[model samples]
Target: MEEKLTDRMCPNCNDYLFYMEYNTEIPYEGNITIKTYLCKSCYYKDVSIKRHDMEKPKILKLKIRNKNDLKTIIYRSPDASIKIPEIDAEISPGIASRGYITTVEGLITGIKEKLSLMDSHDAIYIEERINNILKKNSEEITLIIDDSSGKSKINSGRAEVIEK
Candidate 1:
């Protein structure tokens, strides 16, 4: 019997998939059967057969690069346990090779982290601090002003640091 499955994009060819029905003469009990489709390039059935070995995105090695000069670094793994944030895009679960971390906010977080600490000379202390920050789940760190502005400085607003 053929059953209609919800529309899903074919992971192999990145094409749209839809269910279809046909009249049968052998006498069927069910209403529908799930079918594979791709118009002229049907690869859904084959991909399903070997779906077990599909590679999952490794959060550790995933890197984000830009399309501009490519020399400016967006983000790099500062620690070993980086978590990949789930995005709504349907493009492969792969990290951005060219435009992932292209936003100003993302750039800020990336560059701040990259410039935060020294490599070997300050790894231990910075790691501890980072661990503490992560454990606290603090969204933003606020800095309070101790001394008032001399003449024309704004002293009321707080500068919050958001860790990525």
Candidate 2:
């Protein structure tokens, strides 16, 4: 692993901020670069990850039947589009989007957090429905990931992959 740190001017304030970059290799996976920015003056932070290897476009689908399914690991690339059709929720890659690996439950939680930020009536309703699903009180949900970079994957035998 290699790491670097530099000072940058904060966008909110003219104060100096810390910019960090790291390059690391994961076993069975390719090399990745992680970049982070932190501004102490404005308490702002941002993080993103990029894979070094090129990949083909692909789509992944997974069904969540029970609590055990929530523990399954999911790797999402920055260019991937995540969709939960049951709830009519979708997250597409954007300028501020970042790549990360997390469990199914964590993904739902992340979605809830984003919805909460919207402060809209529809967002709140969808968030509540997602929470019910997370609690296993609702019907099973399906997770679909369309990755143009093909770096995203669901680490489970139940996951279906289709090359685009």
Candidate 3:
């Protein structure tokens, strides 16, 4: 139920968007979990988990056609300026290749992994893969998993984790 963003066109580059499917489960008291494409373009996997903290599951289902698209997802989090908590979103491109642990980019990477977000889309295009990992900051997982709480953090374009 988000805005049916099934179709999105990156203003910078016109690469068709394809959401890498994701299935997530958050824990009631433990860490959040996510299951997404390990190699989405090449290998797709079915993931599942049950946690008490995460009242329900949320799937981000993301796709990156080019560098511009990738950058948007990663930076958009902090730019929103809202502290995200206990999340279970999925993203493609499982690594961060952008910055170090002292810069804004670094915080983005840290937040992503903490949020339990996976950008592991099996990239079919070698060029895209290289760009995503090497040029687009694959080391960082922009999505985050805040402390487990009985609440939902998924919106049309954002997630809001809360306590019950």
Rank the models by TM-score, top first.
Answer: 2, 3, 1
Q: Per-residue lDDT for 154 in model 1?
A: 15
Evaluated at residue 124, the lDDT of candidate 1 is: 49
Candidate 2 — which pairs collide? none
Over 90-140, each residue of candidate 3 has an lDDT whose tens digit, in order, gives: 322223321111333333345444434434443223334333543655643
Model 3 spans > 4 angstroms off: 1-53, 74-164
Best by lDDT: 2
lDDT (tens digit, per residue) of candidate 1 on 46-142: 2111111212222212222222212232222111122323211112222321113233234334434653554654544544444443445223322
Q: Is candidate 2 or candidate 3 better by lDDT?
A: 2
Predicted structure with the largest TM-score when compared to the true one: 2
Better of 1 and 2 by TM-score: 2
True-vs-predicted CA distance for residue 110, candidate 3, Å: 10
List residue ranges in candidate 1 displaced over 4 A: 1-97, 101-119, 138-164
- What are the TM-scores, per candidate, against the unseen true structure? 0.18, 0.71, 0.21
Local distance difference test, candidate 2: 0.84
Question: Which of the two, 2 or 3, has more TM-score?
Answer: 2
